[model samples]
Target chain A: MKHLDFWFEFASTYSYPAAMRIEKLAAERGVKVRWHAFLLGPIFKAQGWRDSPFNLFPAKGNYMWHDMQRVCQRYNLPFVKPSRFPLNGLQAARIACWYQDAKWLSAFVKAVFQANFVKDLNIADPAVLEQILNDLQLDAEAILTQAQSVESKARLQAANQQAVRLGIFGAPFFIAGQEPFWGQDQLELALDWCLHSEANLSSFG
Target chain B: MKHLDFWFEFASTYSYPAAMRIEKLAAERGVKVRWHAFLLGPIFKAQGWRDSPFNLFPAKGNYMWHDMQRVCQRYNLPFVKPSRFPLNGLQAARIACWYQDAKWLSAFVKAVFQANFVKDLNIADPAVLEQILNDLQLDAEAILTQAQSVESKARLQAANQQAVRLGIFGAPFFIAGQEPFWGQDQLELALDWCLHSEANLSSFG
Candidate 1:
């Protein structure tokens, strides 16, 4: 079976839409999606940005807010502009790393995205993450505790390193075989590559 | 008829695609396209960039080249990487400004894009601009000379000022009423807005 890797940053607004819909879309194309939760903070810092570009450039921020509203409306997805520019996703990402290969990873991702984009909830708070885990019937305290482990922290770091190595500059990025597709809008294009490209199927190798 | 403003930078890679295809696409939608030839240099300078972001970030530049190849292949259009990074489009833009109200503006725009991206020619050369004009059955020397006049220079400047006032930060930016859509990818989205948006159709007013 062919697979596409989805690299996402929880703080990324566009990733919210990709997260909400990628699985169903990929499944329709007979492709499996490998969800990889990563951080954009380190990447931005490397680019000498102290904050999200949306905040760094006011006009861009205004345009993005308006664009996001339009996009969400088109997709019929619930969207409320978060009061905060970029919600800290460190805790959520760590927890995602801890449950990286778990069956409920996608559900956890959707819930976290909903918390940040739909509910406008601060995802950085431990209590918020714990509540989400409880809602999923997972052991909240145990998972939260493990997510804070030294090894768990290192795993998240490794993921970021992998993303940087792959030349990923933004979130909601995809790798189908050797081809990298950036942006939520390219989700379908990536899926098409996964379903069709025969020569580069060994790219993941 | 509803209208969409297509703000393009002659040196913009993405604008090449939008310029080549917008007229036919807009015609199909019964939407009128207002081609606005503008310079992105002032906007980039305002953002404190001395070069294209593609040059500022190597990884992004690499990805963009690959992306452009894929896009061209998908569209079945001729693609040749230009010899120069961002060809001096100042002359081409000024020429475009002089022909701004001409019926052949779209054809000239497409021809210029093909020359730069397809043939990898130096669009800044007066000889090249003259050749393109002559091919279109226009008086090459006369138009080229007129394009260099003081009034024509001011016309280009005023167009750039209008783009800045419209919050256009990049090439191939589109404005359908008040909704600004940035990037070549948003061309269809902008057209769709032009066809369906009634309330915001008076945005330009």
Candidate 2:
């Protein structure tokens, strides 16, 4: 099976749908998914945007909210417009980076998404994160402390750097080999490519 | 039958794919498609972009080219990288405006897309457009002359203003009732919404 790297930012509105369903979808296709937590702030800044384009342009911003609502409805996903746009995901991303290889990584990611998008909670709030960690029976203090360590922080920085080097400008981007697919809408296509590309590999070898 | 208004700019790359297949797809679903030709230059300017974002952002431009290649291959549409990014579509839009409800409107739209994307021809060239019209058995000189009329030009301007009024900031936008769906990927969803929403109307009545 081919592997896919799912580059996502916790604050990305589109990534919520992808995060909530990626594991099951990838498993169904017998493809492996590597969850990558990265920040989109740097990418936007590089593009000369001081803020999310949604915030900079009022019309586009309004359309995005309604568009997201339609998308959520289509997917039957619970959605509540976050009270704050682009919730700070630094802590969540660090934790996700630290737990990259853990079995509970997907659970933590989905929980964080639900917290921000469904519960409309401030994901940057340590107490909210602690509750999520505690609910999962993880040691909140220990993990949070470890996640903030210089080493873990460096790892996330490297991940964001990797995303940029890969030419990713948005969240919920997928990379299978050299093929990069952006947006939650391309999830199915990405997974299918992973499967088909791998199947063609042995023939080439 | 439910009606869908496809708001497209001739210079928009993604609209090439949608324009090619929309007529057939709409006919199959017993839906009517209203083609709206408009200029995106004015809209982009309103959004404070002096040029297409594809040109303003190199990384995104590179990614879009590859992504478009993948999409075209998937759809089995012939693909070519246009020598000029966003070839001027002013003349095409004017002509499309003049023929908005003509029986050959869809044919002309698809031909123009094919000329720009498949043949990598400049859609702004009157000679190129004249050839396309001649091939379609239309009076090339007469129609081209009419398309440049002040009234036709104003009609195209009005069409573009309407797009902005409806909060469209991108090409390949579709509207059903008050709902707006942007991007070629959203075409299916827009069509489905058109169908389902119409079906629900009689029940409510």
Candidate 3:
């Protein structure tokens, strides 16, 4: 079976559309999508950014908001600019990293993006994450406890290290074999690379 | 005829593909393209960037080169990493701006991009611009003289100011009606918007 690794940061606005649709798109291409939730905060800080580049560069941010509106409208994905730019996703990311193999993981990822980008809710709030987990029929309290544990926190740190090693500067990022594709718009191009490049299919190997 | 404004910096990598293909694409869609040659230097400076973001960020620079290869391959356009990245496009831009309404403008724009991104030539060289102009059967010396005049310089400066006012932070940006689409990837989307959008087709109005 062909496989591709998808790296997404929860607070990323473009990741909203990419997460909402990637599974079906990948499945259609006979590709198994590996969901890896990661943090952009560390990567961004390393780049000397004190805030989201969008906030720091007002013009890019202005164009992005307008562009995202069009992107969501085109895809029928509901979008509302979050009340706060780049709400913290540390808690959400820990859960995702810890439960990476859980059957409901993808749903949880999508729901969290929706909560932030669609519902304009602060995803950093425990109650918000708990509500999202409960809505997915998962044990909210238990998962929250585990996600907040030192162990889960370490796993997330490791994931960020791995992402940095992979040279991912943004999300949604994808790795098809040894190739890296960035941006939500590159999602199909990445998958197509996975399907067509018979020479390189051992994603993240 | 329906119309769209194309904003391109001669040194922009993605603009290579966008410049090579936009005319045919727009013509096919019954849309007229208004090519606006502009500088990204002022825009970047305003954003506090001392260099191209691609250069300022190493990881992104690495990803961009790889992605450019794939993009070029997918489009069947020639690709070559210039000996110098982001070669000064100032001289070429001045010519492009001064001659924006000339019949041979589009051909000249494509030639300049081909020179910089494909043939690995310094587009900033007057000899290179002269050669491209000579190839177009235009009087190279006369055009070069006019392009270097104070009036031409002011036009280029004005063009950059206009792009800034329009919220254009990157190239190749497109304006279909009042909509601003950034990057070469958005060219088609911009054209489609021009064809479909009825309420705001006055363009720069």
Candidate 4:
């Protein structure tokens, strides 16, 4: 069976769309997904981009907001532009890092995506994340404390390093057998490639 | 009676995909398209980008190539990567400036796109453009001469100035009244907005 590794950031608006759709789409294609949550803030700072490129250019930012609305409409998803343009995704990523189980990872991703895009909550706020945990019936304080553990922090750092090594400079990146696909719109194609690439391998063999 | 203006650059790869699809889609939705050919090279230079941002960043360029392959496959369009990207579009834009009729503009754009992406021909070559003109049953020499006229150059320049004023930084941009939509992928949304905006205006009034 084919598998896709979905690398996403909680603060990423585009990632919200992909997260909302990837699982259902993958199931239809008979492909399994591995959700990998990572922080893009550190990566952006490393690249000297002070903010999301979309925000840096006002026209691009304006267009992106409208574009997201249309895309959300097409997907039949609610889209409320987040109050904070680039929320601190570090805590969410840390939680994701601590919870590596597939089910927990997906739930966390959905919760975070919904919190940012649908609820218009500041994902960086610990209170918002605590509420997310409380709603999920998980131990809010325990998870928040776990997210602050040195091991979890190191794991996030490792994820950021891995993203850089893989040449990712943006959010919503996917890796399938070393091939990287960037952007939410590229999700379907990435899955298709992962599913279809075996034929090329067989031919080469 | 709703019409949307499509601003495109001859050298943009994604624009070819949108250009090939827009007319049919617009017809389906009972909307009209007004094609506006403009140069992005001057615009990028004005923004201090030497080449397409995709090319400037290797990772982005790589992902974009993969993404284009997928988009083309989905559309079932022949998409051989062009050897000369960011092809000198000055002559093409000048010629388009001279020809406002939809028939000539559509055929010329199709020919240019085919030349670059399908045949891998150097679009900057006069001989290649002459061949395209001849194939269209157009007088190659006369068109070429006219495309080079001082008035034609000024017209192209004026179009670029208009793009600057309109806050265009990329190709395949659409304008529906005061709203702007960027990228080939957003063509449908732009068309939809054009069709529905009148209802919005009436409701507001």
Candidate 5:
């Protein structure tokens, strides 16, 4: 079976819907998914945007909120406009990166996304993250400790660098071989491409 | 029984694909389409972007071109990257705005898009505009002359103000009632909304 790399940023509004559904879609098609948690902060800083483009452009921001509501409605994803527009994703991402091979990775990631997007909790808060891990029946104490270790931090930094090298400007981005598909709207296209790609898993990043 | 207002800019890259298929799509859904040819130059200027955002942001530009390829491939629409990134859409928009209710509006709109995104022609030139009109078997000289009338100019200007009031910051935007959907990816959502909106054609703009 072919596979695709799913690059997601925890605080990315669109990535929330994508993260919740990617695995099921991939499973249905018998394709594999590699979840890569990376930061958009470094990438946006490189682009000279001090804030999310949504916040930077008021009109776009206004439209985005409404679009999100419509999208959530269409997908039947429960949504509550977070009191905080973009709560920091660093802690959640670090945990996700450190647990890249964890069997519970997708569940943890989805829980964090739901906490922030559906429940209006700040994902940057360690207490919130701890609760998420506790609910997942994982060793929260050990995982949190491991997530803060030098090796874990280095791994996350490496993922950020790889995201930059892959020319990812936003999330959730997908890679099938060397081809990239950006935005939640392209999820199916990316999955279908992954299954059909001649290069398949060999050339996927 | 229902209708939508399609906000398009001739220079917009994504709008090229939307323009070509909107009529067909709307027709299939038994929805009426109001082609609102408006200028993005003014809207973009207000947002402090002097050039197309594609030129301002290279990564987005790079991704957009490839995405266009993938989208066109999926839609079976022919596409060729124009040598001029965003050829001036002012003249073409003026013609479209003036002929908003003409029997040949959709044909003329699609032809102009084809000229820019398929044939790679400079749509800004009057000769190119005249040739498109001629090919449509219409009175090229008369329509071209009428397109420049003061009333025609003001009508297009009014559309620009209306688009701004509508908070449209992007092309391939659709309005069903008061609901706004941006990007070609949202085309079906907009059309569906138009069809199902309780207000139906009454509240459509």
Candidate 6:
């Protein structure tokens, strides 16, 4: 079996689509995926970016919304433009970090994506997050409290650092050995490399 | 009978893969493609970008190179890093502007992509472009001379201005009426929309 390392940020619009589909696609291809959740905020700040570069450029932002619409239609997924661009992904990322399990992470990601894109909820709001946690039947207070812990903060910082070292500047990135693939659309090709590359395959087996 | 407009830049790496495969894919789906060649250099400059944002950030550039290799491998196409980060696409774009026939533009684009990525030649160089033109059995001097004409230059400018007005900031963008799809990977979805959208398909019949 071959393996793919999936690195994603909760706030990334495109990552939502990829996160929703990657696991199923990988399963069909008989590949294992290791879900790694990280925060892109710190990385962006380090680069002196105030927000997602897409948001900084109005034209790019407009184009992205239209692009997302087309992609969502193709995948038969609902897409509504989020009212807020670059929502605070801290709490969600923290919960993802705390759980660190593939199943929980996947569910959390799907919920967040749906909440932000479909339901148009402000993910940054603790109340909204609490509701999501409650719906998942998880310990909402405990998780939310833990999300603010010093250890949790350090974990996120480390993830950002890891992303920087890996030469990742965008969300929805995948790494197979030294090779890195950016964007959700490249998911299939990235998985293919993991499945066929002798060096990458050996790691999973 | 449905038609989708493909806007591409010769400097775009992923566009190579898309241009090579799109015609066959469109034919299989019984869709028609309209190739729109334009230079992104002016657009980027207009947006106050000095270069491709990928090149502005080292991490992005590094990841993109590796990512493209995987995609090329999956497509079984040759992949090699071009010597120049962003080739001067003005000459090629000018040539494409002269033709409305999709087949000619497609073949020309494929040749230029091969020249830069496979042959590792300097596509920005006039002599190299001359050779490419000669190989294609097109008049090198005449095309080059015509490419310099004010009329051809104005056409290139107009094409770029059209891209910006349509909210496009990236290479390999597609438009189906008012809907826009960015990136080479999104071509299929763009084509699907062209084929399915009542407003667009009506024009075909």
Q: Evaluated with lDDT, which candidate comes out highest?
A: 3
Q: DockQ, in order, for the candidates?
A: 0.43, 0.47, 0.55, 0.30, 0.46, 0.45
Model 6 sits at an interface RMSD, in angstroms, of 7.9
**Residue A16 lDDT, candidate 5, scale 0-100:** 94
Model 5, residue A82: displacement in angstroms? 0.5
Model 4 chain A worst lDDT run, 10 consecutive residues: A196-205
Distance from true position, residue A128, model 6, in Å?
2.2
For candidate 2, give the DockQ.
0.47
lDDT of 4 by residue, B1-205 (tens): 8888889888888888888888898898898888888988877776557888778766667767766776687688899988777687778778887786647778888788878878888888889889989999989999999999999888888988988788787888988776787877778878888877865332100
Which segments of candidate 4 are over 4 A away from where they belong?
Answer: A28-30, A42-48, A175-181, A188-205, B27-30, B165-167, B176-180, B188-205
lDDT of 1 by residue, B85-166 (tens): 7888888898788787899888888899999999999999888888898899988888888888999899999999988788
Give the poorly placed runs of model 5, Cα more than 4 Å off.
A199-205, B199-205
Docking class of 3: medium
What does candidate 5's lDDT look like per residue over B61-127, in tens digits? 8888888887897799999989998899888899999999999998999999999999999998999
Scored by Cα lDDT, where does model 1 land? 0.88
Against the hidden true structure, what lDDT does model 3 obtain? 0.90
Clash pairs of candidate 1? none
When 4 and 5 are scored with DockQ, the better candidate is 5
| Candidate 5 CA-lDDT value | 0.89
Chain A only: TM-score per candidate: 0.96, 0.94, 0.96, 0.93, 0.95, 0.92
Whose DockQ is greatest here?
Answer: 3
Taking the tens digit of each residue's C-alpha lDDT, what string does model 2 give over A54-76? Answer: 89887778888887887787789
lDDT string for model 4 (A137-161, tens) is: 8889999998999999998888878
TM-score comparison, 1 vs 6, better candidate? 1
**Reference-based TM-score, model 2:** 0.95
Top TM-score prediction, candidate number: 3
Q: Ten consecutive residues with minimal summed lDDT in candidate 1 chain A?
A: A196-205
Which 10-residue window in model 5 chain A sums to the lowest lDDT?
A196-205
lDDT of 1 by residue, A124-201 (tens): 999999999999999999999998899999999999999989989898899998889999999998999998778544
